[model samples]
Target: MKLRTWGFYFAEAWRGVVGNGLMSFASASTVALSLVALAAIVILGANLEHMTRMLEAQVQVVGYLKPDFDRRWSDLLVQKVRAIPHVTDVRFVTKEEALDRLRSELGPDSVLLQAAEDTSNPLPDTIEVWVDKPSQIPGVVRAMRESVTSLDSVDYQQEVVSRLAALTRAVRLAGAGFIALLLLAALFIIANTIRLTVFARRREIGIMKLVGATNGFIRWPFLLEGMLLGFVGSALAAAAAWAGYRWLAAQVALGLPFMPILRPDRVLLPLSEALVAFGVALGGAGSLLSLRRFLRV
Candidate 1:
């Protein structure tokens, strides 16, 4: 398409919006609201998944050695765990360390425990294994159980690991479903709004048809109009989402210092770009679909 022709289409599209001001505003608002909802869900899910992965990194398998197990075999087992793929860190905790930990945890009862320390601290020497990936847990556990020379029992937060995995899957499924519903709603609203625009200008379209205007020529203006509205609406939604995320981050920092809650700049920027592209495509598709039935030429 030539620059002049493109300009003409743009002009006509803008004119259409100006001619039907309230209808156009309503359509744009519909698209904006839908995009905003979709973006919010996506941002929330992304940040949460990031935080959960961080939490998962803190999860570890504590392999307690038998009381009679040799210290050499325990050291060997710790080395083997450290060599496992995705294993981040493995530290051997002696029975003494465990006893000390227990004592500290008991607080006021520490003095009594110290007095009876000769009763044989039943705590076993253990190895705490941490991995980079959550999926590595089962394999690491199996390897330690089978390949390790000494391990009485492995104690890990199985419930937490399982629930986190399940939660990640649920979040993905729910995010997809929410986005689909919002896009569908946006399409319907844009189609109805554009349908009215086409109806109000039915006579003008008939005249253009008589003047030898092709289908492509008639379609371009509506498509461009829809795309323009989508772009503007998406920009507004992105701005609102960013501001909301900033506020959320501040609140998290103030109230939950220990919790993992970083600003979502990396996640949100790409998502905002995606939202703009998706919104434009949806609007153009909806406008074209609506205009076709009414144009009939």
Candidate 2:
């Protein structure tokens, strides 16, 4: 389309809003509330995903070597385990290294450290495998036990791993459901808003139909109006959600010093862009459906 044609469409859409100020406000408010709920869900899903990842990162499977195993066998085991698809890192912790770690954990003032140093260090050399996915650990452990001969036993936190897996699955399901409901709500709000606006201008539409105006020409302004309403509402919603996310981040930082809350900044721009696309798509869809059903001329 030409620039002037585009400009005219925009002006007509703007005029529609100006002509029905109250209806416009109502439509914009509806869009804003629906988008705000969607934004909250996105933020919540993001945090849950991050927390799950942190927990997964901390989980590892340790394969302890037999007491008389040669150092070369331990190296061989580390290399074989590292070949696993989701394995991120594999480290061999020697008996002396384990004892040193235990000593550091028990401070110099600890009598336990002295007693530990005096006795024969019972800690065995082990290969610790860090995996990218919690689900991969069980398979990797099984494969290592079958393939590697020097390893005595594999140990992992079964309860923690199981719970993490369950939590991840539930969060994903809930997130999908929330997003689907929010989109449906947005569609209903926009369609009803357009219907009311069209109803208020029924006489004008009747006269236009009686005259030479085609359906497309009559439809352009209302469609553009819906688009504009959605865009503005989504912008406001994004701002509100961003403010809330920042405030929540501050509280998290103060409350739990150990947990690292990801800065929402990383996802803000992408999320904003997604919202704009969503608004445009929803607005266009709602306008088309409403006009087709109600504006029969």
Candidate 3:
């Protein structure tokens, strides 16, 4: 289309919005609210996924050696553990190092060390095994239990690992279902809003048809109007979501420093772009669908 024709379409769109001020506001508000909810879910799902991955990376299996197990065999044991399928790394922790770790954990209280100085260290040697992936941890642990006869105990945070895996799956499934619902709701609302606008202009539309104007020409203004509404609403939603996420991230940093929170730049930037694209697509689709019935006239 020519620049003048595009300009005319935009002007007509603006007039339509202004003419149906209340409906336009309602449509924009609906878009804003839907996009806001969608953005929140996206951010939350992303953060949860990040947290899950962090937890998985930290997962390890600690195999405690029997009390009488010879320290010289530590290297051999490490090699054997590393040979296990899916085991990515293995480190042997001596009894003495375990005692020192205990001391450090106990803080400045040297009394425990001083009392045990005369006695043989009761702390057992440990082999720390890291797997290629978190899901492999359980299998690796089972293999260790079966192959390492000298193991006094095999341990890992089984409960935490299982819960994290379950949580990740739940978040993904729930997020998908929720986003689908929101998209459908937004489509329906926008389509209904545009339908009302078309209904109100029925007489003008008939006159335009009588004057030999094509349906495409009549359709462009409403399409542009819907897209404009979606763009404005999504912009507002993105701004609000970004501010809210930053505030929440700061709060999490202060209150729960150990917890992993996704940075805004890494997550929000992509999310904002996605929201804008979604809004525009949904707006255009809704307008096109609503105009079908009117165009048949």
Go through the candidates in order and give the C-alpha RMSD of each one to the true structure.
5.5, 4.9, 3.8
Expressed as tens digits, the lDDT of each residue in 1-297 for candidate 1 is 789999999988898788888878877887888888887777766766776676677647888887788776666677788888778899988999988877775664566676659688877888898877666788888888887756789877656766866776787788789778878888887887778778877887888899999888888888888887788778888888888888888888778766676566876788889989987998898898798777775
Superposition TM-score, candidate 1 onto the true structure? 0.76
Error of 2 at 277 (Å): 1.5
Clashes of each: 0, 0, 0
Residue-level lDDT of model 2, residues 1-297, one tens digit each, is 568867877887787777778877777777777787778777776776676567667647888889988886766777888887778999989999988877776558788777767898878998888877676778888888988788899898655757766776777788678778877877877787778768877777788899967788778878998898888888888888888888888888877766656787976777888887778778877778789976665
**What TM-score quantifies how close candidate 2 is to the native fold?**
0.73
Best by lDDT: 3
Query: What lDDT, from 0 to 1, does candidate 3 have?
Result: 0.84
Model 1 lDDT, residue 179, Cα = 77
- Model 3 segments more than 4 A misplaced: 66-70, 94-125, 133-135
Off by over 4 Å in 2: 2-4, 54-59, 63-89, 94-126, 131-133, 139-162, 257-261
lDDT of 1: 0.80
**How does each model score on lDDT?**
0.80, 0.79, 0.84
Expressed as tens digits, the lDDT of each residue in 101-164 for candidate 3 is 8888665568888676668887788888888876687899988988888999988865686787
> Candidate 3, which ten residues in sequence have the lowest lDDT sum?
51-60
